[model samples]
Target: MNSVSTDLIIQSIYETLYMVSVSLLIGTLIGVPLGILLVITRANGIKPKRIFFTLLNGVINIVRSVPFIILLVAITPLTRLIAGQTYGSTAAIVPLVVYIAPFIARLVENSVLEVGPGIIELAKSLGASTFQTIRYFLMPEALGSLVLTMTTATIGLIGATAMAGTIGGGGIGSLAITYGYERFNTFVIILTVIILIIIVQIIQGIGNRLAKKLRHE
Candidate 1:
């Protein structure tokens, strides 16, 4: 490959990172609160509201049911409105954030649910307020599991970033699709795959270590 190709690959990598990280940050901000509400609004939750819980839960489910690619196309107009266009890394983030926010909400709901009922009782016994109970007891107890869930979310974001490339989102995935598959350039495909593997490994390893540390604490 020429120096130009090498530079393109590096730039693609940066674009992928930019999309994934920005979406993850924004998604996490939206998702974590929704997850907390899902837990705290159920029938048995601290502040049960049957109608609200049911409605919120349904919306999350409906979004999750749609496939990511379809969601990408379906939200193109909104993407254009938010990102000011329907293509490229910045525009890609609108759909990516939309896709991952509810996904992270579900993951967070499951992770937070894994905290035992006993912990809730303990918090009550200590006279912790609703916010205090969640902040001090549930969150602390589920911290380790939440870390793992976020790790899974991160990896999922990476895959979605590649898919975003199909629509001119521009990343290693686009490079592979344009040069590797379309032009039958085996090297780009292999290189992209290897780079993705290395990225996933690094994320998983960090998650494991962080979870272990939280567990020890």
Candidate 2:
């Protein structure tokens, strides 16, 4: 490829990263807390409630049930409202955040559930309030899983960004679609695949290392 093509590819990667980071950040801001709430309010948990758990579970299921492509199209209006346009990396974040947050929430809920009930009871026996228990015990104990889940979510968002590219959101995937598939440019398609594979490998490696460190702690 020419230098100009290389430059464009690099720029597209950076734009893709920006979209993924913003979406993941926003998703985590909302999802982690909701996960905690789901854990704490379950019937067997500290602040047990049947109705609330059912409602939260239903909401999560509904969000998860929607396919990402459909959600991407459905949120175009909201994306345009927030981004002032819905056909670029910046515009892609709106649906990406909405798509990943509930999955992250469920990951967190599962991780928190893995914590021993005895640990929770011990926190209570020490007179720890609900907030304290979660803050001191649940979160700390689940930090490793949290890191892994975030890693997984980040990778998922990368795929979402590729789909966003089909709607004119510029990325390697968009380049592949417009130049590779349409024009039958096999080289661009192959190169884009290589770049994506490298990105996924790096993310997974970092996540595994972090999770291992957290486990040792």
Candidate 3:
């Protein structure tokens, strides 16, 4: 039983990583652009478009407001369509991406907003194109903050993946439910909690280091 428990725990860690990493990658790719658009379409943005911003903002808000567990079940059909049968770690990535993308977008928007208005004005005064300003000035200035934002989003993804496990999306969460709770194995529950803590600490530590490095550079 000890050997089996160890093997299950190890496999669960890999499954959790698989879901979180792929979801985070896709979410960041889509969310970052959406976030940039959100910022640049606002009243004081580089090219304000009130109607467009309002619609987009509404969509983002609606999606983000939904709880992850509800979203997971709500999107199961879509997930099946995408992954050709939902349940495993790969299938779980579909909803995880959907759940995290808007969150990442909002985080990114806030990060970019932290870049001062003065810097934007300075870029404008120099006749910088919108792309040039964002690429050179805004994004670079906010890189450190963005790193922290990604870290926060990644942490959220971790939690979401655990919830995904309830629906046969195998991970440490499923292990906890099956072995820890169902079988009344306190050791398994304790181990799962410790493992989760270790993963979070590692992610945070790396994010902190990267943010510090970017800020210094």
9-96 per-residue lDDT for model 3 (tens digits): 7899999999899999999999999999999999999989999999999999999999998999999899999998787788898999
Model 3 local distance difference test score: 0.91
Indicate the residue-level lDDT of 205 in model 1: 100
lDDT of 2: 0.88
How much does candidate 3 score in TM-score?
0.96
Candidate order by TM-score, decreasing, is 1, 3, 2
- Which 10 consecutive residues of model 3 have the lowest summed lDDT? 1-10
What are the per-model C-alpha RMSD values against the true structure? 1.4, 1.7, 1.4
What is the lDDT of every predicted structure here? Answer: 0.91, 0.88, 0.91
Quickly count the clashes in candidate 1: 0
Q: What TM-score, computed on C-alpha atoms, does each candidate reach?
A: 0.96, 0.94, 0.96
Clashing pairs in 2: none
Which lDDT tens digits does candidate 1 get at residues 29-110? 9999999999999999988999999999999999999988999999999998888899789999999999999999999999
Runs of candidate 1 exceeding 4 Å displacement: 2-4
